[model samples]
Target: MKKLTMALIALPILAIGTTTIAGMKYASDDDRCERGERYSQEDRQKRNPDKMVERLAKKLELSQTQKNEVKQLFINKQQQRETMREQMQSLHKTLRGLDPSAADYASALAQAKQKAAFMAESKIDERMHMKAAMQKILSPEQMAQFEAMQSKRKHHQGMER
Candidate 1:
């Protein structure tokens, strides 16, 4: 009787846990994307330039001048990305007005691709600028250290997979 009662209790607990997991799996993708946990602009600013410079300075053992220059570079890149995001959002809004089955769909898709290409170009430009700025700020030895750190991070990420 005790074994049967214990099994009855365990069965409901397992069923409840499985149901919770299944419900999460079936939840709306849009609802997940637009959830209340989204970061605000203020949160983004707090996370950028200033926080990045502090972290990089510790990792690279940067001088005051190098830290200042790196921070400025990060700020400029962040602003450029924000502008690109706005342009992309506008293009997406325009694309949304066209019917998916219309002949204009091809033209709309082409414009969307152009916008995506522009954003990608801007990202590459930002990365190049960052590399150049880092090169100017860091010594050869420091650059080696940075590369090693990046490699370790990549390896750790791969292990997680």
Candidate 2:
């Protein structure tokens, strides 16, 4: 009976100890980055265009036509980003496969880096295009509010890093 009572008490302590250790294991930046990447991939798979439209409509008080346009814009931008992401992944894979001991390795790595930069630039350009499209869709006050929201998002992202 004494052993049973001690075991019962120990069970909760053991559980809490394991939970604390598990939480601490994920406290590093590397763990957070891996988790963030996994979460983003899952989120992309689960994200609904209609739900995004509804949320944006509520936030921006968008008209029906504006909502439709914004939905299309979001779809196009996501497609572009996916294409760019694929290209970047391919470049990274190529970089990983190249022999570091080879004479051409430096050139190959540089070329891969250049392609990655180009892909990144394309994504930024696409974002600028989206911003321009939104400018046409949103009222001046709405655009200002949108810019403020973007700034806040960027600030938060910077803090996260």
Candidate 3:
């Protein structure tokens, strides 16, 4: 009778512990793409890219070929972003050397701005490419759903600020 009573008492504790651990894992995974703590390329490669492909495939009902193409597109975009970030870092270093108020500083600043603009353009192109790739994979309804989700996310972000 004592063993039975102890087992019943321990059961709820074990269930609650399991629930807490599972909830923490889910929260961490869901917030991987959040700003400020955005996942690095290595982390994305390890956890996100494949998971995204899988989830998107399930959500969009993608075929195997489409999934493959979308995955490649994502990988390419990730690489391009890494390259753009490196270019931005290099340009920042150049900007740091020039005196902000000097006559020559205008030309230096212009050059830096040009480089920054190019980087931004590159990222825009990458986004377009990824969207195009996704379009090939997702049905019209699924595409609309994805767009709605993106819009909602942006709105929520704006609200948070």
Clash totals, every prediction: 0, 0, 0
RMSD per prediction, one decimal? 4.9, 6.3, 10.4
TM-score of each: 0.71, 0.73, 0.64
Task: Please report, in order, the local distance difference test score of every candidate based on alpha carbons.
Answer: 0.81, 0.83, 0.79
lDDT of 2 by residue, 21-140 (tens): 988977875563555455467567567778888987898888999899888988887787778777877987898899999999999989988888888788788878889999999999
lDDT of 1 by residue, 1-161 (tens): 99999999999999999999877863865443454555568666776688888888998899998888888888888887788878877877877776888888988888888888878887898788777777787899988897788779889889534
Question: Can you give the lDDT of residue 118 in candidate 3?
Answer: 83
Off by over 4 Å in 1: 1-9, 17-37, 158-161
Per-residue accuracy of model 3 over 87-155 as CA lDDT, tens digit each? 887988998888977888888888888988888887788778778877877788989988887778889
Lowest-scoring 10 consecutive residues by lDDT in candidate 1?
Answer: 29-38
Residue 156 lDDT, candidate 3, scale 0-100: 88
Return whichever of 1 and 3 wins on lDDT: 1
